[model samples]
Target: MGIVLNQSLKNTIITYLGFGIGAINTLYLYPVLLGATFYGLTNYITSCANVIMPLFAIGMQNSLVKFYSQYKTIDEKSRFLSFTVLFPLVLIIPMLLISLYFYDEILYFLSKKNEIVKYYVWLIPFIGLCMAYFEIFYAWARVHMHSVFGNFVKEVGLRLFSLLLLIAVNFDWLTVEGFVYATAGLYFLAFLVTMFYAFGIQKPTFQFAMPSNSKEILTYTFYIILSGSVANLLLDGDKIMLNQYMIIDNIAFYSIATFIALVISVPSRAMHQIVYPITAKLMHENKFEELNVLYKKTSINLQVVGGYVMLGIFVNINQLYAMIPKEYSGGLLVVFMIGISKYFDLILGNNNAIIFNTKYYRAVLFLGVLLVAVAIGLNMLFIPLYGIMGCAFATLLSITLYSVAKLLFVVKRLHLYPFTAQTLYSIIITFILFILFYFWEFPFTPVLSIFLKALLITLIYVYINYKFVISTEINEAIDFVLNKIRK
Candidate 1:
């Protein structure tokens, strides 16, 4: 448990480091150097490839984690890993080929004008394959409780490599076409790095022995594909939708704001990766009480961390955008909506993981697909009328519905609820903090005002939490930091 906590702390730090680099690249460098449209195209293309990669993955990543413990022998695990690799490739390869065949048609349908879509067309398969295998390798590492390397590679390594590409563009060393290819190429490189690391650490062998359990594995994989696809679309569908309905520049503006908003999810992402297998192990042992405790702790802690992050970004948004050009500032609303949506998911803790790892996993995903369909329908109706704000609103509603449904399902099936008097208390405390700060606008430059506002909000919020103990979990976290500093 201590090791898990330490590794999580390390991963969280690295994720923020990566976020810092991304903040510079997406919000400042890309928009300043490439303009909003090209930046949007870059983001949309990368997200499209990402969203589609899971479709090819066939849920093998989650399946790998869920099924690994069932195999006791070393050889059995090896065969299982090999089969995991084979399963996703079998589907991913064909899908890539098909997409390639219809590349031109896809471009025409996705864009309003005959833009330089071909420059990035080849990246579809390359990125899709890269992303597919990255998840596979990460899953392989995760089952061994060695997730920090994968998290670093996935979260930080990609951003570092992308930062290099941005530097090239900023320095006039690469054209937009070159930048696009570089973006795709970086994922492939990161995948390779993680693969080598997995081999070094797990040294998983390349062998197959048709376990009698293979049938169960295959069935799980099949359902997981649908599940993975739906999850992918729910998260990544907005960029795809934006690409289809608007210009690349709009996507760029939206992407910049989305990047900032995504910072709010760092805590959730770090916690989830470590918590998933832990939760699965608890379920496997029928330790329902432990699972319940974990659910509540995770929800409260995640909200504590994510709330601070969202507060920082919200309080500093105007100054943050002032750092960028005026043209890209329209994404401010997108940032707020998406940030709230993601933080809301954080508030639900590991509800999705609980559902996916349980017996009712398939039904959970089926419901996810229905919600995703509604999300797409709403985006279609909204993106055209309200542009990025519409997409943001649609996403917020869809994810809220999805989170509520999952929460209800878990409460019914497991008889667990991740809320308490503290939850309501935190809400009230947060609201009062917002109200106190809302009326305290100072007469200063936008940049100065944002800096002062963020400082005051941080101080006031912290003081309130300390005074009221809105979250004992958070108070303890603060104590830990203070103790470390004293040392």
Candidate 2:
């Protein structure tokens, strides 16, 4: 718990810093500098790249974490690490060749509904390749318990690059086209920096020999490819599908709403960096009791933190939209809808790590494929009717079903439940805070209104949580911070 708390705290700070930077890029800078159409185009291209990245890497990032702890000797570990690093080439080389063979046709197909996309179609694979390797290298470092630096590169470094690019474009130093290309280049740069950090942690000799578990490793990677694709698809498929059914700028509108909602999830994402490998280690050792304890604790801790963020967003949503450009304000409902699904994700803490690391993962992969179909079908059906809000509806429905199914599967298969009475308490408290504060309006400006409401909400929420002790872990965390402040 010491190392977990230490790294998780650092990562939470880094993730929020990244999100803060992203908020600037998304809400104000991009709209002011790039305009809605180009902003949407940028987000759409990156989303497409994300949807393809899991396939390009072919699940080696997860495979490395799942298998790294199983190797007993340095030689075996080195061999396994080398294989995972090189394994993605199996798909990358062939995929690149295939794309080249039918490049124009592919672009033509993708840009049919949004022709602007054809102009930047080539950046998709470039960014996808970069993103895939970044995760692989990040995982490389995570297996060595060096996730904070990798998290910084992933979270802060890339967004900082975007800020620089935005400034360049704002100054007439580069065209919008150049800005888009520079974004891809930044992803590649981040990947290289992460690779350097990973190798600095443990430089591999690139052992050519395969580990004895090659067969098992390859099999798990194959299934995880489908699982990974499904997960990423549900996440970004809405934006991609929005391109097909609606205009390009609608993607930007939807992106802003989703970004706001995604803040509810930063805690889980940050904690997962270190907790995932630990969960994998515990499962590898068959330590169910300790694993169970970690699982329950993570769920409550995430809910306590994530619920607070959700309350803040929902409470001050009106003020937030009031500050942003009017055009981007249409997706307020999208924020609430997506935020709920993400909260469910938090409540199911480390569920993905548990599933992906264990033998039961195959069942979840099949479930994920079915959910992917449902998500795409829902998006195709709903976006035409509801527009950007429809995309959020489809995502919320698909992700909720997926999450509930995973929760049930984990309970049945491993008998490890992440929910408790305190989980219910957190949910109720979240709604109480939302109802009390969300509708309350201040006579002040949006910024001041947000501060006043958020501060009040935080005070009430924190006092109740500490008084009733919603989560002992959270209580301890608060005490630690208070003690540090006193010191």
Candidate 3:
């Protein structure tokens, strides 16, 4: 618990710092600097790369984490490590060739509405390849229980690089086209750094010989590809699909709205880094009781923290948007929809860790494939009808349904539920804060108003929760912070 809390806290801070830099790039710099069309084009390229990354990665990042601990001998571990590093290339090299063969046709389809995308179509594979190797090596570091450096690279490094690029563009130091190329270069650079760390953690002996359980590992890798792809599709698919049905510039507005909501998941993402390998070890030891406790605590702790982010975003969203250009203003509904989905994601806690580490992962994988189809289908139907709002609607429905299905499966198969009585309390607190602050506003500048409202909400909300002892975990965190202050 101590290690998990310490690492999660550090990770949460790093993630939020990254997100703050990203917010500036998205809301302030992109809209004001690049305007609508270029902003949308930039996001579309990255989103497409993310969607393609899992397939190129061949699920070896996940498979590495699951299988690395199975081998006992250093030689055997080296061989297994060698397998994870090399297996993905078998898929990546061929995919690159196929991409080259169909490059023109692919460009035509992707650039149907926004021909600007054609100029950068080649970046999709380039960025995807970099993202693929970064994760593979990041997972390598995770299994070594050295996740902070990886987290810093993942959460902060990219955004920091992006900030410098955006600044360059803003100051007339570079053109937008140059910014695009720099973005691709940044991803490749990050990949090299992560690969270096991975090797340093455990210098691979390059023993590429096959283990006896080669079949088992390859099988898991195959399923995890779909599993990995499903998550990316749900997160980035809406933006990609928007390019087909509507003006590509609309994604800029949608991106800003979703960014405000996506911040809610930062805690969950941070905690999951360390939790994943720990979950794997726990499951391997058959310690269902410990796993169950972890599941509930994570759910409640995430809910408590994520709930605050949701409140802060929703209550002050109007003011936040007011500061942005009017063209990006139709996203209140988008934020609400995506924000709620993010909260649901947080409450599920380490459910992903459990499912991915367990044998039943394939079942979840099949379910994910089905849901990806449903998400794409829904986007096709809804985006045409409601425009960007419709896109949000489709995402909300798909994510909600996906989360419910996951919760039910975990309950039925693992006999573990993340919900406790305090779960209801957390929701009630979030709702109460929303009700209290949603309509209240100070007649001041947007920044000052947001600060006062947030401070008031934090004070009243934390005081009430502490008084009631809503969660032992939250109470303990409060105590630890207070103790530190006194010392």
**Candidate 3, residue 142: lDDT:** 91
After superposition, the stretches of candidate 3 with alpha carbons farther than 4 Å from their true spots are none
Worst lDDT run of 10 residues, candidate 2, spans: 431-440
TM-score of each: 0.95, 0.98, 0.98
Writing each residue's lDDT as its tens digit, candidate 1 over 130-234 gives 898899889888888888888988888898888888888878899876888778778889889988988887776676556668787777777777787877787
**lDDT, candidates in the order shown:** 0.80, 0.91, 0.90
Could you tell me the lDDT of residue 427 within candidate 1?
Answer: 69
* Residue pairs clashing, model 3: none
lDDT of 3 by residue, 32-53 (tens): 7788998898899999999999
Q: After superposition, how far is residue 259 of candidate 1 from its true place, in Å?
A: 1.7
TM-score, candidate 2, is 0.98
TM-score of predicted structure 3: 0.98
Question: Number of the top candidate by lDDT?
Answer: 2
- Give candidate 2's root-mean-square deviation (CA, Å): 1.0
Ranking by TM-score: 2, 3, 1
Candidate 2 backbone clash number = 0
